[model samples]
Target: MDLNSVYQRLNTGSKKWSQYPEDVLPMWVADMDFPVAPPIMQALKNRLEHPLLGYSVAQDTLRQTLVEHLARRYGWHVQPQDLVFLPGVEPGVNMALNTLAPPGSGVVVQTPNYSPLLSAPANWKLPRVDLPLQADANGEYPTDIAALQHALLSARTFLLSNPHNPMGKVFDREELQAIGDACVRHDVLIVSDEIHADILFDGRRHTPVASLSAEIADRSVTLMSASKAWNIAGMKTAFAIIQNADLRERFNAGRLGLVDSVNALGLEATHAAYSQGEAWLQQVNAYLQDNRDYLAHAIKNRFPGVRMHLPQSTYLAWLDCSALDIQHPQAFFLREAKVALSDGLEFGEDCGQFVRLNFGCPRPMLEEALARMERSLQPPA
Candidate 1:
C-alpha cells in the first residue's frame, strides 16, 4: 500500500495538518503527519465489525503484551497489577499529582518542556517548580545534576519528560540515574512522561526513569502511550505503570473518579500496534530519521542565525531563532512567514525567542516549510 496516500487521508480533519487550512502547512502539533500501521487499521475495523461495543477489560494477552513490550524495549518488568488505564497521558498526569502530592506542593518539571507538564500542575492547584534546562552556547540540553537535586529537595514530585520536548536531547542514562537518586534522597516521587520512547532516531536509547533502580522504580509512575508514535492521540488511551505496591496503592487512591474507561476501538488499535506493527514501526523510524537529518542539514548548512537541535527521539525540532530577533519570532513566523510552529513561550518563561517545529511531515512538506522560513528570515537589501 502507498503510505503517502494513507497519510494524505489523515488530512481530512487532521489536527496537525488540515485544521489550519489545506493551503497552510502545519509543522506545529505533535501528531505525526503519517498513516497508522495497516495492522492497527485492520484491528480497529475488525473490532467495529463485531457490532456490539461493550465495556472493556484488560485481557491477559494484552497485559502480557505490555509486559513483553516493556521487557524487550526498555528492560522494565512491569507487573500486570501495577498497570492502570487512563483516558490519556494528560489525565494520567493529573491523577498522579492529585493522588500523590497534597495541595500546594510543587510539581517539578524541567523546562522548556511539554506545556502540558506546566498546565497539569496549574489545573490541579499544584504549583509548578521550573528547573529550566541549562543549554550550552550551541543549544544542547545538558542535564544539571546539582540543580535537579536542588529542585527535588522540596518540590516532592518531578514530571520528567524523557527525550524532552522542545529540546530534543535524550537524557543520558547516567543523568537519569542521578536525577532518580535525587528524587530518592529527597523522598520525591518521579512521574515520567515517556510517550516518545518508541520514536527514537538513529541509535539513541530511551532509558525509563523507573528502570534505573528498584528504589526509583518503587517511587516512579511511568506514563506511556501509542498515541504519539501511531498518530492516535484522539484515541484516548494511555497506561500508567507503578512498580511499587505503595506507589500503586497511592496512585489508585483518588484515581477512581479521575479514571475513564478505555474505548474498545482504542484497545484494539493498541493491541494490534504492539503485536503486529514492528515492520511498520521500523519504516516510520527510518523515515523520521531521514526527516530529522534533512532538517538538521538545512538549518546548519542553509539557514544561518537559526539554531536547531536534531532530536534523537521525538519528531520535535527545537529551533533557537533568538539571533533572528523579529519581535516575538514565533508570532512573526505565523503572521509573516505564514508558518505555524509551537512558540517557545509555551514551553517556559523567558524562552519565547525559540520555536518548536514539527518535522514529522513528508520531506516535500518540510522542504517547502524551510523554503518559506528562509525567505522570511532574509534581510531586506
Candidate 2:
C-alpha cells in the first residue's frame, strides 16, 4: 500500500524513459512515468523467486481474480471459459482482423483511434473503411453510427476503441448500444479494444460494447489488459473475452501461436493487480485526473491557439493544433519544440492537424513540457 517506496524504486529499464537517456523529457510513448502498484511488483518478484519459469497454465486464482475485478469494476460478468490469452491488445487487433474478415475486405473504425487499428486492416489486406468521429456541440469526438451503417455492408468487422486511445472518449451506454445495434444489423463482428476500460474519469464510465446486450456480446471479442493501468506492458500479456461459442471457436482457429504463452511473471503481476490493486488504482486515477486538468488548463491559457480536450478517461490528451499554420504541427513540436508527440496524421487524415500528448508523468515533468511548448509557439526573434 505504500506507493512512495514504489515511486522511488520505479525501474530505469522503461522504454518510454530510457530510450532517450540524455533528453530532458520523453513523452512520446504511452507508458506511464509512475511506478507499478506495490502489490503487482511484489507478485512479480515472488514469481521470479521461483527458480523455474516455464509455460503458464491459467489457474483458478488468476481466472477468478479477473472475473471478480470485472464484476466489481464494470458489472460485466466474464466467464473464465470464455477467455483467450494474447500477448497484447495489438496482437488481439491483428488476430481479429485476420480471423473475422474475409481476406481483403474492409474494416470500419473511427478516425483519431489508436494508430495500430488503422494498419490492422491494411496489414491483413482488409481495406480501411474510415468512419470519422463527428464532433458534437461540446467538441468531443463521438462514434458516427450513420457513417458506420452506410459502410457496414462492405465491411466485415467494426473495430472499436472503447475509452478511445488518443481522444479518450468513454462512449456512453446509449452511444455504445447504437454502435452495437449497427454492427449487429450489418452482421459485422464488433472487436472492441477495451484496454482502457478501467481508466475512466469521475463522471464517465467505460461500457464494453459486449456487455450492452446479449446480441452484441455474442458478436464481440473484447480485448483488455493490466498493462496500461499497472505499467507492466513489457511483460506482454493480455486477455480476450469472446462470448459466442461458435464465434470464439472460429476466431481463435487462425491463431499462429503469436501470443499463446505469456510470461509467468506477467501472469502473477496481472493477478495481483486485478485482485489487490483497488486502493492504489484509486490514487493513480485521481493523480491522472489532476494531470488531465493541468494539461488542459496550461495549454488553453499558455497557448490560446491550441485546442485540447481533457480526456474523460485515458491519460493521453488529443490536441487540435490546427491554429498553428505549420506544414505539420506535430513534426514541428518534435523537431523545434523537442517534445515528441504522436502524429495525428498517422492515426488518420481526418486528424491531420492534431497531436497526441502523453501527460502521465510527475506534475513537474509535465510543467516543464508545457513550458517548452509555450516557447515553441513564440514568433521569430
lDDT of 2 by residue, 133-251 (tens): 86789887777777778989888799999888888888899889999999889889898999988886876777888988899998999999998887778888898899898878877
lDDT (C-alpha, whole model) for all candidates: 0.83, 0.82
Give one clash count per candidate, in the order shown: 0, 0
Number of the top-ranking candidate, with lDDT as the measure: 1
TM-score of candidate 1 versus the correct structure, residues matched by position = 0.94
lDDT of 1 by residue, 137-167 (tens): 8666777788877777669899988878877
RMSD of 2: 2.2
- Which residue pairs overlap in candidate 1's backbone? none
Worst 10 residues of 1 by lDDT: 1-10
